[model samples]
Target: MFEHIDFNNLLATYGYLAVFIGCLLEGETILILGGVAAHQQALHLPLVIFWASLGGMLGDQALFWIGRYFGARLLPRLHRQQAAIERVTGLIHRHPLTSIFSVRFLYGMRLVGPMVIGASRLSPLRFSLMNLLGALVWAALFASAGYWAGQFLESLLGDLKPYRLPIAVGVVIVVGGIALARHLRAKAKEQHKA
Candidate 1:
Protein backbone atom coordinates (compact mmCIF):
# COMPACT_ATOMS: atom_id res chain seq x y z
CA MET A 1 0.00 0.00 0.00
CA PHE A 2 2.86 2.42 0.79
CA GLU A 3 4.97 1.57 -2.25
CA HIS A 4 3.27 3.95 -4.63
CA ILE A 5 4.12 7.15 -2.76
CA ASP A 6 7.21 9.04 -3.88
CA PHE A 7 8.76 10.83 -0.92
CA ASN A 8 10.54 13.36 -3.11
CA ASN A 9 7.38 14.27 -4.96
CA LEU A 10 5.46 14.59 -1.72
CA LEU A 11 8.14 16.86 -0.35
CA ALA A 12 8.33 18.92 -3.52
CA THR A 13 4.61 19.54 -3.58
CA TYR A 14 3.87 20.24 0.08
CA GLY A 15 7.26 20.74 1.67
CA TYR A 16 6.89 24.45 2.38
CA LEU A 17 3.52 24.06 4.08
CA ALA A 18 4.81 21.09 6.01
CA VAL A 19 7.82 23.02 7.16
CA PHE A 20 5.74 26.01 8.20
CA ILE A 21 3.17 24.00 10.16
CA GLY A 22 5.80 21.72 11.62
CA CYS A 23 7.85 24.64 12.82
CA LEU A 24 4.74 26.10 14.32
CA LEU A 25 4.07 22.94 16.32
CA GLU A 26 7.59 21.53 16.91
CA GLY A 27 10.40 23.20 15.00
CA GLU A 28 13.78 21.56 14.85
CA THR A 29 12.94 18.20 13.33
CA ILE A 30 10.72 19.66 10.62
CA LEU A 31 13.29 22.28 9.67
CA ILE A 32 15.85 19.53 9.39
CA LEU A 33 13.52 17.55 7.15
CA GLY A 34 13.01 20.59 5.01
CA GLY A 35 16.73 20.95 4.72
CA VAL A 36 17.04 17.32 3.74
CA ALA A 37 14.42 17.85 1.08
CA ALA A 38 16.30 20.89 -0.16
CA HIS A 39 19.51 18.93 -0.34
CA GLN A 40 17.64 16.48 -2.54
CA GLN A 41 16.48 19.38 -4.76
CA ALA A 42 12.91 18.50 -3.91
CA LEU A 43 12.64 21.85 -2.19
CA HIS A 44 14.68 25.04 -2.15
CA LEU A 45 16.88 25.59 0.88
CA PRO A 46 16.40 29.35 1.15
CA LEU A 47 12.64 29.04 0.99
CA VAL A 48 12.73 26.33 3.58
CA ILE A 49 14.63 28.68 5.84
CA PHE A 50 12.23 31.45 5.03
CA TRP A 51 9.14 29.42 5.87
CA ALA A 52 10.79 28.03 8.96
CA SER A 53 11.78 31.44 10.16
CA LEU A 54 8.33 32.85 9.56
CA GLY A 55 6.58 29.92 11.21
CA GLY A 56 8.92 29.96 14.18
CA MET A 57 8.50 33.69 14.75
CA LEU A 58 4.73 33.53 14.43
CA GLY A 59 4.53 30.60 16.81
CA ASP A 60 6.49 32.39 19.47
CA GLN A 61 4.56 35.52 18.83
CA ALA A 62 1.32 33.69 19.41
CA LEU A 63 2.64 32.22 22.61
CA PHE A 64 3.81 35.63 23.71
CA TRP A 65 0.40 37.12 23.08
CA ILE A 66 -1.25 34.28 24.93
CA GLY A 67 1.00 34.91 27.85
CA ARG A 68 0.36 38.61 27.75
CA TYR A 69 -3.40 38.21 27.78
CA PHE A 70 -4.07 35.04 29.74
CA GLY A 71 -0.89 34.12 31.52
CA ALA A 72 -1.93 35.25 34.94
CA ARG A 73 -4.95 33.04 34.82
CA LEU A 74 -3.22 30.25 32.97
CA LEU A 75 0.01 29.98 34.93
CA PRO A 76 -1.48 28.82 38.18
CA ARG A 77 -2.74 25.70 36.47
CA LEU A 78 0.79 24.65 35.56
CA HIS A 79 1.98 24.07 39.05
CA ARG A 80 4.50 21.49 37.99
CA GLN A 81 6.33 24.11 36.00
CA GLN A 82 6.99 26.40 38.93
CA ALA A 83 10.69 25.86 38.94
CA ALA A 84 11.15 26.30 35.23
CA ILE A 85 8.81 29.25 35.26
CA GLU A 86 10.71 30.89 38.03
CA ARG A 87 13.95 30.29 36.24
CA VAL A 88 12.59 31.87 33.05
CA THR A 89 11.19 34.78 35.00
CA GLY A 90 14.53 35.30 36.69
CA LEU A 91 16.27 35.18 33.34
CA ILE A 92 13.86 37.74 31.98
CA HIS A 93 14.48 40.02 34.92
CA ARG A 94 18.21 39.74 34.69
CA HIS A 95 18.79 39.45 30.93
CA PRO A 96 15.59 40.10 29.11
CA LEU A 97 17.09 40.63 25.67
CA THR A 98 19.41 37.70 25.91
CA SER A 99 16.64 35.52 27.22
CA ILE A 100 14.32 36.55 24.46
CA PHE A 101 16.92 36.21 21.74
CA SER A 102 18.32 32.92 22.95
CA VAL A 103 15.08 31.33 24.07
CA ARG A 104 14.42 29.38 20.87
CA PHE A 105 17.89 27.86 21.02
CA LEU A 106 17.30 26.55 24.51
CA TYR A 107 15.84 23.06 24.73
CA GLY A 108 12.63 23.09 26.76
CA MET A 109 12.60 26.85 26.89
CA ARG A 110 11.84 27.27 23.20
CA LEU A 111 8.13 27.38 23.90
CA VAL A 112 8.02 28.52 27.49
CA GLY A 113 10.52 31.36 27.39
CA PRO A 114 8.41 33.56 25.15
CA MET A 115 5.39 33.00 27.33
CA VAL A 116 7.40 33.88 30.38
CA ILE A 117 8.57 37.03 28.67
CA GLY A 118 5.07 38.00 27.74
CA ALA A 119 3.82 37.30 31.23
CA SER A 120 6.58 39.45 32.56
CA ARG A 121 5.13 42.35 30.66
CA LEU A 122 8.16 42.91 28.50
CA SER A 123 7.80 45.23 25.53
CA PRO A 124 6.02 43.59 22.60
CA LEU A 125 8.09 45.39 19.98
CA ARG A 126 11.29 44.23 21.63
CA PHE A 127 10.12 40.64 21.73
CA SER A 128 9.09 40.76 18.11
CA LEU A 129 12.42 42.10 16.95
CA MET A 130 14.50 39.65 18.93
CA ASN A 131 12.15 36.80 18.11
CA LEU A 132 12.61 37.53 14.42
CA LEU A 133 16.37 37.49 14.75
CA GLY A 134 16.36 34.34 16.84
CA ALA A 135 14.02 32.51 14.47
CA LEU A 136 16.31 33.26 11.52
CA VAL A 137 19.38 31.94 13.29
CA TRP A 138 17.62 28.94 14.79
CA ALA A 139 16.01 27.98 11.47
CA ALA A 140 19.30 28.32 9.61
CA LEU A 141 21.22 26.22 12.11
CA PHE A 142 18.74 23.32 12.22
CA ALA A 143 18.04 23.36 8.48
CA SER A 144 21.73 23.40 7.66
CA ALA A 145 22.26 20.64 10.17
CA GLY A 146 19.78 18.54 8.22
CA TYR A 147 21.38 19.39 4.88
CA TRP A 148 24.88 18.63 6.13
CA ALA A 149 23.73 15.46 7.81
CA GLY A 150 22.42 14.28 4.45
CA GLN A 151 25.80 15.10 2.94
CA PHE A 152 27.61 13.13 5.61
CA LEU A 153 25.27 10.19 5.30
CA GLU A 154 25.58 10.22 1.51
CA SER A 155 29.37 10.14 1.86
CA LEU A 156 29.10 7.16 4.17
CA LEU A 157 26.37 5.23 2.33
CA GLY A 158 27.33 6.05 -1.30
CA ASP A 159 23.70 6.79 -2.18
CA LEU A 160 20.75 8.53 -0.53
CA LYS A 161 17.99 7.94 -3.06
CA PRO A 162 17.15 4.53 -1.75
CA TYR A 163 17.22 5.74 1.87
CA ARG A 164 14.92 8.75 1.59
CA LEU A 165 11.85 6.94 2.85
CA PRO A 166 13.72 5.35 5.69
CA ILE A 167 15.26 8.66 6.65
CA ALA A 168 11.86 10.40 6.73
CA VAL A 169 10.26 7.54 8.63
CA GLY A 170 13.11 7.48 11.10
CA VAL A 171 12.78 11.19 11.71
CA VAL A 172 9.03 10.88 12.29
CA ILE A 173 9.44 8.01 14.68
CA VAL A 174 12.15 9.71 16.69
CA VAL A 175 10.26 12.97 16.90
CA GLY A 176 7.07 11.16 17.83
CA GLY A 177 8.86 9.17 20.52
CA ILE A 178 10.32 12.27 22.03
CA ALA A 179 7.00 14.03 22.00
CA LEU A 180 5.25 11.06 23.54
CA ALA A 181 7.88 10.83 26.20
CA ARG A 182 7.44 14.46 27.10
CA HIS A 183 3.69 14.07 27.18
CA LEU A 184 3.88 11.02 29.39
CA ARG A 185 6.28 12.74 31.72
CA ALA A 186 3.98 15.71 32.02
CA LYS A 187 1.03 13.45 32.72
CA ALA A 188 3.01 11.61 35.31
CA LYS A 189 3.86 14.86 36.97
CA GLU A 190 0.24 15.88 36.90
CA GLN A 191 -0.83 12.59 38.39
CA HIS A 192 1.86 12.76 41.00
CA LYS A 193 0.70 16.24 41.93
CA ALA A 194 -2.88 15.09 42.20
Candidate 2:
Protein backbone atom coordinates (compact mmCIF):
# COMPACT_ATOMS: atom_id res chain seq x y z
CA MET A 1 0.00 0.00 0.00
CA PHE A 2 2.84 2.43 0.78
CA GLU A 3 4.92 1.60 -2.26
CA HIS A 4 2.68 3.27 -4.83
CA ILE A 5 2.50 6.78 -3.43
CA ASP A 6 5.02 9.27 -4.66
CA PHE A 7 6.08 11.16 -1.52
CA ASN A 8 8.01 13.83 -3.38
CA ASN A 9 5.04 14.63 -5.54
CA LEU A 10 2.73 14.56 -2.57
CA LEU A 11 4.92 16.92 -0.61
CA ALA A 12 5.37 19.22 -3.56
CA THR A 13 1.66 19.47 -4.19
CA TYR A 14 -0.03 19.16 -0.83
CA GLY A 15 2.66 19.78 1.75
CA TYR A 16 1.52 23.18 3.01
CA LEU A 17 -2.11 22.17 2.87
CA ALA A 18 -1.33 19.07 4.84
CA VAL A 19 0.65 21.08 7.39
CA PHE A 20 -2.19 23.56 7.82
CA ILE A 21 -4.89 20.94 8.22
CA GLY A 22 -2.71 18.76 10.39
CA CYS A 23 -1.84 21.57 12.73
CA LEU A 24 -5.44 22.66 12.86
CA LEU A 25 -6.17 19.36 14.57
CA GLU A 26 -3.23 17.68 16.32
CA GLY A 27 -0.09 18.80 14.47
CA GLU A 28 3.07 17.56 16.11
CA THR A 29 3.48 14.58 13.83
CA ILE A 30 2.74 16.57 10.71
CA LEU A 31 5.13 19.34 11.74
CA ILE A 32 7.90 16.86 12.35
CA LEU A 33 7.19 15.17 9.03
CA GLY A 34 7.20 18.55 7.30
CA GLY A 35 10.56 19.30 8.87
CA VAL A 36 11.89 16.07 7.53
CA ALA A 37 10.55 16.93 4.09
CA ALA A 38 12.21 20.34 4.36
CA HIS A 39 15.51 18.73 5.16
CA GLN A 40 15.05 16.54 2.13
CA GLN A 41 14.30 19.69 0.05
CA ALA A 42 10.72 18.63 -0.64
CA LEU A 43 9.29 21.58 1.27
CA HIS A 44 10.52 24.89 2.65
CA LEU A 45 11.36 25.01 6.34
CA PRO A 46 10.08 28.54 6.94
CA LEU A 47 6.86 27.83 5.11
CA VAL A 48 6.37 24.69 7.14
CA ILE A 49 6.81 26.67 10.33
CA PHE A 50 4.44 29.39 9.14
CA TRP A 51 1.66 27.02 8.14
CA ALA A 52 2.06 24.94 11.24
CA SER A 53 1.98 27.98 13.51
CA LEU A 54 -1.01 29.47 11.75
CA GLY A 55 -2.92 26.22 11.91
CA GLY A 56 -2.08 25.63 15.52
CA MET A 57 -3.07 29.16 16.51
CA LEU A 58 -6.30 28.99 14.54
CA GLY A 59 -7.29 25.66 16.05
CA ASP A 60 -6.68 26.81 19.60
CA GLN A 61 -8.47 30.08 18.99
CA ALA A 62 -11.52 28.30 17.66
CA LEU A 63 -11.61 26.03 20.67
CA PHE A 64 -11.12 29.02 22.93
CA TRP A 65 -14.10 30.82 21.46
CA ILE A 66 -16.18 27.68 21.71
CA GLY A 67 -15.33 27.42 25.37
CA ARG A 68 -15.94 31.09 25.87
CA TYR A 69 -19.39 31.01 24.35
CA PHE A 70 -20.54 27.54 25.32
CA GLY A 71 -18.25 26.31 28.03
CA ALA A 72 -20.96 25.49 30.50
CA ARG A 73 -22.87 23.57 27.88
CA LEU A 74 -19.75 21.83 26.63
CA LEU A 75 -18.14 20.91 29.93
CA PRO A 76 -20.41 18.01 30.70
CA ARG A 77 -19.67 16.45 27.34
CA LEU A 78 -15.95 16.53 28.05
CA HIS A 79 -15.84 14.36 31.11
CA ARG A 80 -12.42 12.94 30.26
CA GLN A 81 -11.02 16.44 30.10
CA GLN A 82 -12.43 17.62 33.45
CA ALA A 83 -9.24 17.06 35.39
CA ALA A 84 -7.08 18.83 32.84
CA ILE A 85 -9.54 21.68 32.58
CA GLU A 86 -9.50 22.18 36.33
CA ARG A 87 -5.72 22.14 36.44
CA VAL A 88 -5.47 24.67 33.64
CA THR A 89 -8.18 26.80 35.23
CA GLY A 90 -6.19 27.05 38.42
CA LEU A 91 -3.02 27.91 36.54
CA ILE A 92 -4.86 30.55 34.54
CA HIS A 93 -6.18 32.14 37.69
CA ARG A 94 -2.75 32.28 39.28
CA HIS A 95 -0.50 32.82 36.25
CA PRO A 96 -2.55 33.59 33.20
CA LEU A 97 0.27 34.51 30.84
CA THR A 98 2.45 31.61 31.79
CA SER A 99 -0.45 29.23 31.55
CA ILE A 100 -1.38 30.45 28.10
CA PHE A 101 2.19 30.29 26.84
CA SER A 102 3.10 26.93 28.31
CA VAL A 103 -0.12 25.00 27.73
CA ARG A 104 0.91 23.96 24.23
CA PHE A 105 3.93 22.22 25.69
CA LEU A 106 1.94 20.03 28.01
CA TYR A 107 1.22 16.55 26.63
CA GLY A 108 -2.45 16.09 27.49
CA MET A 109 -3.35 19.72 28.16
CA ARG A 110 -2.98 21.19 24.67
CA LEU A 111 -6.66 21.03 23.74
CA VAL A 112 -8.22 21.50 27.15
CA GLY A 113 -5.94 24.26 28.32
CA PRO A 114 -7.19 26.85 25.83
CA MET A 115 -10.79 25.88 26.51
CA VAL A 116 -10.35 26.29 30.24
CA ILE A 117 -8.66 29.64 29.75
CA GLY A 118 -11.42 30.77 27.44
CA ALA A 119 -13.94 29.74 30.08
CA SER A 120 -12.01 31.95 32.46
CA ARG A 121 -11.58 35.73 32.29
CA LEU A 122 -8.61 35.82 29.94
CA SER A 123 -9.23 38.16 27.05
CA PRO A 124 -9.22 37.00 23.45
CA LEU A 125 -6.34 39.34 22.63
CA ARG A 126 -4.21 37.91 25.39
CA PHE A 127 -4.92 34.36 24.32
CA SER A 128 -4.25 35.14 20.66
CA LEU A 129 -0.85 36.67 21.34
CA MET A 130 0.23 33.95 23.71
CA ASN A 131 -1.16 31.22 21.41
CA LEU A 132 0.76 32.60 18.46
CA LEU A 133 3.99 32.66 20.41
CA GLY A 134 3.44 29.18 21.72
CA ALA A 135 2.55 27.83 18.27
CA LEU A 136 5.66 29.34 16.72
CA VAL A 137 7.89 27.94 19.42
CA TRP A 138 6.25 24.53 19.20
CA ALA A 139 6.51 24.44 15.40
CA ALA A 140 10.14 25.51 15.40
CA LEU A 141 11.15 23.10 18.13
CA PHE A 142 9.46 20.05 16.57
CA ALA A 143 10.42 20.90 13.00
CA SER A 144 14.03 21.36 14.00
CA ALA A 145 13.97 18.01 15.73
CA GLY A 146 12.64 16.39 12.56
CA TYR A 147 15.25 18.11 10.42
CA TRP A 148 17.97 17.08 12.86
CA ALA A 149 16.73 13.52 12.80
CA GLY A 150 16.96 13.52 9.02
CA GLN A 151 20.49 14.83 9.19
CA PHE A 152 21.50 12.23 11.74
CA LEU A 153 19.96 9.46 9.70
CA GLU A 154 21.64 10.69 6.56
CA SER A 155 24.95 10.72 8.31
CA LEU A 156 24.43 7.25 9.66
CA LEU A 157 22.81 5.58 6.67
CA GLY A 158 24.77 7.52 4.00
CA ASP A 159 21.62 7.82 1.81
CA LEU A 160 18.10 8.73 2.88
CA LYS A 161 16.44 7.98 -0.44
CA PRO A 162 15.72 4.39 0.40
CA TYR A 163 15.07 4.83 4.09
CA ARG A 164 12.57 7.69 4.13
CA LEU A 165 9.50 5.46 4.33
CA PRO A 166 11.04 3.28 7.03
CA ILE A 167 12.02 6.31 9.06
CA ALA A 168 8.58 7.83 8.72
CA VAL A 169 7.02 4.56 9.78
CA GLY A 170 9.33 4.34 12.75
CA VAL A 171 8.42 7.84 13.88
CA VAL A 172 4.71 7.09 13.52
CA ILE A 173 5.03 3.86 15.45
CA VAL A 174 6.96 5.45 18.27
CA VAL A 175 4.57 8.35 18.58
CA GLY A 176 1.53 6.10 18.31
CA GLY A 177 2.96 3.79 20.91
CA ILE A 178 3.49 6.61 23.33
CA ALA A 179 -0.02 7.91 22.72
CA LEU A 180 -1.47 4.45 23.23
CA ALA A 181 0.44 3.99 26.45
CA ARG A 182 -0.78 7.29 27.78
CA HIS A 183 -4.36 6.47 26.85
CA LEU A 184 -4.18 3.11 28.55
CA ARG A 185 -2.66 4.61 31.65
CA ALA A 186 -5.39 7.23 31.81
CA LYS A 187 -8.07 4.59 31.31
CA ALA A 188 -6.57 2.41 34.00
CA LYS A 189 -6.52 5.33 36.39
CA GLU A 190 -10.15 6.05 35.61
CA GLN A 191 -11.05 2.44 36.28
CA HIS A 192 -9.12 2.49 39.55
CA LYS A 193 -11.03 5.56 40.63
CA ALA A 194 -14.30 3.93 39.63
Return the top candidate by lDDT.
2
Candidate 2 worst ten-residue window by lDDT: 159-168
TM match of model 1 to true structure: 0.88
**lDDT computed for candidate 2:** 0.87
Q: After superposing candidate 2 on the true structure, give the runs of residues whose Cα lies further than 4 Å from its correct spot.
A: 1-4, 190-194
TM-score of each: 0.88, 0.93
Local accuracy of candidate 1 as per-residue lDDT tens digits, 39-101: 878888999999999999999999999999988998777776665678789889899999998
- Local lDDT at 80 for model 2: 85
Over 16-38, each residue of candidate 2 has an lDDT whose tens digit, in order, gives: 99999999999888888889888
Regions of candidate 1 where Cα sits further than 4 Å from its true position: 173-194
Backbone clash pairs for candidate 2 read none
